[model samples]
Target: MTSQLSADYKVDHFQKKATVVGLVGAAVFLFAAVAPYIFATDVTSAWIKLFYLISLATTWNLLAGYAGMVSVGQQAYIGLGAYGIFVFNDMGLDPYSSVLVASVAVGIIAFPISYVAFRLRGGYFAIGTWVIAEATRQIVIRFDSLGSGRGRSITTYTEDAIYRNLFTYWVALAIMGLAIVATFYLLRSRLGVALQSIRDNEVAAKSMGIKVSQTKRIVFVVAAMGAAAAGGIICLQGLGVASPNTIFGVNYSAFMIFMVLIGGIGTIEGPIIGAIIYFLMDYYFSQMGLWYMVVLGVLAILIMLFLPRGVWGEISHRFNFKVFPVGHQVQPLFPGIKLKKK
Candidate 1:
């Protein structure tokens, strides 16, 4: 009875924590989506930019932090996802709905490409991914329909302007919420266990009957899909104007990695934390000019050298804090061993 009661208490504790996080996350997004109307024009633009930061960090977290895949070429999909939507909208589809199409399409396209890239390992894999992204950019640049290095935009949404702003806001929020909830749920399932196992030891997991390539490929595709969704929504919010350079810029990749590393790699809470800090920095130092990018580089280097496991990881290890706690713990020292402290 006591053991059962203890387990129930643990479950309840977890539920309460998740509820709190969910409500807080929802509130933050709500404010962001509506901030444009409540504040000065300049302040509104800043908050909207923060949404892109959050979206990128979340997508990067899904990849490296969770699935343990690191690719420097993710901007390839971001560029493609952004550019892809404008094509749909030009053909008379609603720009917002095109975001979903671009996301799924990117996922499908990335799958077979993963087979080619997965052939390499470690540093080679990383470079190969970047090469692919560069090639993708070059291809888009050759197409005049995509503005050929210049940006192109949808003049109108086929669905008309009736509640377009609200629709875009809801869609962006929906994508963020979906990624968060889906990631948490996935991590709770056996798939999550499999992913963690892969992260810990790929060879050992394979030896124990895990389908290594298939799992990695699936995760890679899913991460691409999530990133694509973010990119598409971002393009929509910018009025269906997809600029290849801005969306596919290497800086986008760098920013995402910085946010995840500084926040806490391998944990859900870490990337979001890192992103908020980045947003704050962008807000303050933005007027300071290109020095902002320099600052980001220095900050990332400092965090890595000083707090290797990242902010949240360090905090958790040092004090055993579990703000986003998902693991289990035990009370007694052994299954049937117990002693009185007194």
Candidate 2:
């Protein structure tokens, strides 16, 4: 009787809601794809910034929030991606193509760097990443062809301003879309379960036969690739790297943290919400100079104190719905079924 009753229960990961979200998201993407036709270049160009911001925030959230690896050195890959464009573009690849090539190359580079970074844990791991980033910046500036300490421009790009902005806007949109879609699907996979387990407790995850190191290494490389892609877009949009310092700036990581934390760490929707908020704040208040930064800091502190789970985290906690439901739920096939103990 107990065995028969067990058959009445099943585990479900709501695919329907995810499907609905995916379809709606795709429609939005379709509209965004042709935005340059509907809006001015200036208007669309601003979107390029927002797109990359979302990309950065999403990737960073995946790395730190889901994987529990807080890295402050992601700018290492970002700078590499920016520099890779120059390297490949010089080899005759166009800037757009260079961004793709750069992302792949940075992923390859991140594999070995992960070995070095994985040696540390907790705060040590965080600091180790920062050191690695600084070292990367130093090594990059030593090469004169890549501009030494100064910056260089992409001389091979199309000269038409309209076409250039249009292409850039599309590439930025693509990167942003890829980041969101990849993250959603990745979290829906078995590895996503392992990742959440590792985030909860690394030792316990290992005890459960999860390959904690390998899972983290995979996430690290993927995050690096995402950061690199966004970095490549930054260089392409600007037409060149003005300074390695700016491209590899620690401030970029700080902003990524702000976005992830404010949006809600560990949830996919949180970073997107956070990035939009940060983008709007930056857009309107940037002209305020020091006051702008002060406002940002104060606001972040207030949110952390009040809405510690982040805005989306708090909302989801109360409302009990997920746009991307990656967790499983148990339900009985027969509502009235009751299993008797042996």
Local distance difference test scores for all models: 0.76, 0.94
The residue pairs in collision within model 2 are none
**Tens-place lDDT digits, model 1, residues 179-292:** 767777677666777888887888999998988888888878887887788788778767754567777778778888898899888887777788889999987897878788
Best by TM-score: 2
lDDT of 2 by residue, 1-342 (tens): 347645889878788888988999999999999989999999999899999999999999999999999999999999999999999999999999899999999999999999999999999999999999999999999999999999989979989999999999999999999999999999999999999999999999999999999999999999999999999999989999999999999999999999999999999999999999999999989999999999999999999999999999999888886788788777779869665532
Ten consecutive residues with minimal summed lDDT in candidate 2? 333-342
Model 1 residue 308 CA deviation in Å: 1.6
Model 1 C-alpha RMSD vs. true structure (Å) is 4.3
